[model samples]
Target chain A: MLPHLQLGAEIEVGPGDDAAVVRLPSPRLVVTTDTLVEGHDFLGHATTARWIGRKAAVQNLADVAAMGAAPLALVVAISAPADTPAAVFEELTIGLTARAEADGASIVGGDLGRAGQLTITVTAMGSLPLDQEPVRRSGALPGDVVAIGAPRLGRSAAGLALVLGERALVRAGEDGRPTIMLRSIQDSSAADLLRWHDAPDPDLSLGWTVGRSARAMMDLSDGLVRDGRRLAAASHVTLDLDRAALAPDVEQLTGLAAELGADPWSWVLHGGEEHAMLACFAPGAVPDGFRPVGQVLAPTAHGPEVLLDGAPIEGAGFDHFG
Target chain B: MLPHLQLGAEIEVGPGDDAAVVRLPSPRLVVTTDTLVEGHDFLGHATTARWIGRKAAVQNLADVAAMGAAPLALVVAISAPADTPAAVFEELTIGLTARAEADGASIVGGDLGRAGQLTITVTAMGSLPLDQEPVRRSGALPGDVVAIGAPRLGRSAAGLALVLGERALVRAGEDGRPTIMLRSIQDSSAADLLRWHDAPDPDLSLGWTVGRSARAMMDLSDGLVRDGRRLAAASHVTLDLDRAALAPDVEQLTGLAAELGADPWSWVLHGGEEHAMLACFAPGAVPDGFRPVGQVLAPTAHGPEVLLDGAPIEGAGFDHFG
Candidate 1:
């Protein structure tokens, strides 16, 4: 039997009903959804069900935050094989509830069914604060400062590389077990990187702050270059990111990059899954806790472009279908 | 490229952003989500992508109607194999958008991804009228009259049997083609039954009307016996049906049952996916357009039960994880 979900004060009628009724903070509701497929979104062996649940919740929570709205509630629909462990389901619920609760939201309702693969679909709802307008992706103007909510970038991608590399080594060895290889790379920084990749802690508070002041905003899930290009295209403006401003973020990844024989700058510019907020603010409107990395320019005949150090840089980021 | 979605007045901000901001009708929002998997929810070959899309939308739409709420918007998340034909996606979208539009709701936003099997998760939001409160499942009392939104039942289940039996015969043949078998069963009534199975058109208007006065209400996705039992348990009452009242509905299905060598009474009592509204009304409070089928009684030591013609009937309805 499933555990009883505590009904929050905002929930007039929670789970077990035809639909849940939740109090809305504003007259408008911000809604978004995301689906995570097994093998594609997470590796079963490399991650716990709890972490997978956490990741799934965070994906949508970050989207709500990117809208600059206060999180309200989440409804999830999960499908998995019938033979899946009950403990996995329990752990997943814990992860989902824990993450949503931390973000000031609750799992209001859900549906469970049998499927060939495990899939989690989360729909997040949020409300804007009184007198605040939602920051859109099409509001950027020429001369606006492009800033990032956090300096940490590419840590998740670097951590993924380390984990995948270790898995490959384990498969190549005589014994399939990865105990020896895992011990060989027991560095603290690598552990930190792996943790970041496993479960990202996005600064949702910064998203709220930016929503109040930024003209345009979005979350960086698909890396700087790719998502930056999206922001530029949406706002009909070109973004020119300064190399000097990104050097520190890239330098932080140099150690992991060297260990894996990769480029740190590539990780910083093109790695994804960081869930950092990227926004455009009027000159001098950029707030604290955000670092200026670029400037918006008028659109050209060739359309919007994202530049690095005055030159266009091709970005290789994850695409769900591509 | 995705087609441009027309923005309705209710949609403050549509797709292309982190989330959509939709104007709410009431201070409380009704939310629900449902997922349809490739193998479990439908057979890809047997059902067209468009019908599949419509079924997905209606499932959630009916849930909102059961709450007596006016549907506002829907957000969908779909996952399919990367190599799937683009036409399939287009047709599915056509189905989803068409159905949502028919219900006075728009497909405000969605996410797409690659997966081994095609999957769709829909989250629907609705608003209750200013004076009406949501009818819950636990509000029924003893002596309440049990009513049904429509007198027709079991047509969908009967149709499914005919289709599946035909599919089995087709696979047994040398050429593995079902055209001959399909043509052999070309009764207009049978076609209507199959059509109902393929795409159920539940009268959602009746749902809104019933929500205004029903003491307890739920959409019957599971068979009447099973879902009726659920309603009985939720309200701590036993539902005793008069066999004479259900005779007409069962007689309607007798012809299809004979063609398929099935039991009409069983289908009427145990068939599911009808999405008909089952409600309890205070004695003599049953609204127009709804047929009284049974009456509620106080719970006994045997617990909640659904009786047919003064005797308890066993129902083996479809269970997702059963």
Candidate 2:
């Protein structure tokens, strides 16, 4: 059923076997796994199987990118109801194939079984250059320049808000005040935001491109504010973000935010699943396609925290329990 | 919660990161994935979370061993109900850690999310010797000796029949004749059989030990009759078995089989999930732990078939769809 998988030369043996054998140029292998479940990660009725597959692949590829490794191969495991249509699996494989190929990786093998709800788990492997070490979250230091590749953020959270309607935006506020202001305005950017939420397109090359120079890095999956706090905590430093530096990203979404009656700042700070690369680099070492968003600083006795314009911001983002 | 996870020195980074980095001594990597879903792979009411995790890990480890690779590391992705007890996750992690360690591998990383049902997907990666090539299913040739490591098969199926009771055995028959005669038997082997069915213990070292000399190798997940057909078809050969060679395995279980009024031969030939290593070696190349049960011959016009004492046998084994 998975005809779209292209067997690369590095794959000594592909699917239809007990396991697949692959050749790696480097001895260090970067590995990660993630899963998407029906009714939790997606609404099976609203989202197509193909898009679900695409989103699943993007999540793993982004995780590898966050590790400063080049994507290599992925093995997918899928469990669905027995009554599910054959076309659904075909489309899902096609989606997975397209996304893996786009990220310069291939789908080498997978297992299929029956379950009550449809779930897809993808485990991705990656490689690093012979002499370079992985850029870890614990490597950021004081005076490091905090930057982001593909600076546009929060579009996914915006898209999810749109999909869930006005109540979703209204309920997202921590305080009693409305977090977003909704209005009807015709704009294609809203559609783009929705597409980003449905199937994110991450820049997979950004990790390997900055691997040699970046001090620390991660995928911006849980919003700028929440993930920024994690990066700071991991490195035992404080991240002081410049609000003006993020104003452009907010401005780009302002058109749709106004129509949805949403606060652009809320989306910029708390939106998630954007799948963009966030990294800390030495001064004067920021690579092309990355923009400075903040600076790393020594943590006070209060512990590592995210600061906006010299004021501490409370952590808030996608929490499955919350 | 995952306190039992003993991170080996090969793991550069463990859990709590976006992904993990591990060192592979060999350039060639063998990868496989498998998933267990509640209500299908296991009944949540009947199976403990720990045994489920153990079985899930064993399935993947055996797949890696089937490829003649040494198990190195595994990444697990779990999805469960948000209301699930915290202790359940702890026990599950302990189970995964135990099985992985027993097989000389480590749990390197994982992701957790909420889902309607508890589900786990494990992706295992293994390494091969620099000078050795992987043993593939299609490598068997005419005149190869068909052998199996730890030749005690069908214990898991017997255990399953015991757990499922008499009706399950009754429904397993193909021609309406009683395949098993159910009767109460006072034997600890019955409990041992149940344990094997629940959490199989596969010989992880057998693969790499015989990898260089074995012409073909695969894990016996399905029944011997079923997997043998696959091996025969893949290699364009017929597997002509000596029933006398398999009599000992059936004899071991004959005590319980006779007590239950079940035919020992049925379990030996059609029972699955033993996770034993099945390989084809040159007549004199069979390794120390392996015992010969059959021999390979050229396929006839009717195509590759499995034979018993010079007579062709119809294919019968575990079919998920069937």
Compared with the true structure, what per-residue lDDT tens digits does model 2 show for residues A28-127?
8899999988878876534567777899899999989888888889999989999988777876787898899988899999988888888999999988
| Candidate 2 global TM-score | 0.92
**Listing candidates in order, what is each one's chain A TM-score?**
0.91, 0.91
Q: What is the interface RMSD of candidate 1, in Å?
A: 1.2
Model 1 / residue A115 / CA error / Å: 1.0
The alpha-carbon RMSD values of the candidates against the true structure, listed in the order shown, are 4.2, 6.8
Residue A96 in model 1: shift from native, Å?
1.2
DockQ of all candidate complexes: 0.74, 0.65
Each model's fraction of native contacts:
0.81, 0.87
Across B76-99, the per-residue lDDT of candidate 1 in tens digits comes to 999998898877777677777788
Name the regions of candidate 1 deviating beyond 4 angstroms: A1-4, A166-187, A320-322, B1-4, B168-187, B320-322
RMSD of 1: 4.2
In model 1 chain A, which range of ten residues has the least summed lDDT? A168-177
**lDDT of model 1, residue B54:** 81
DockQ of 2: 0.65
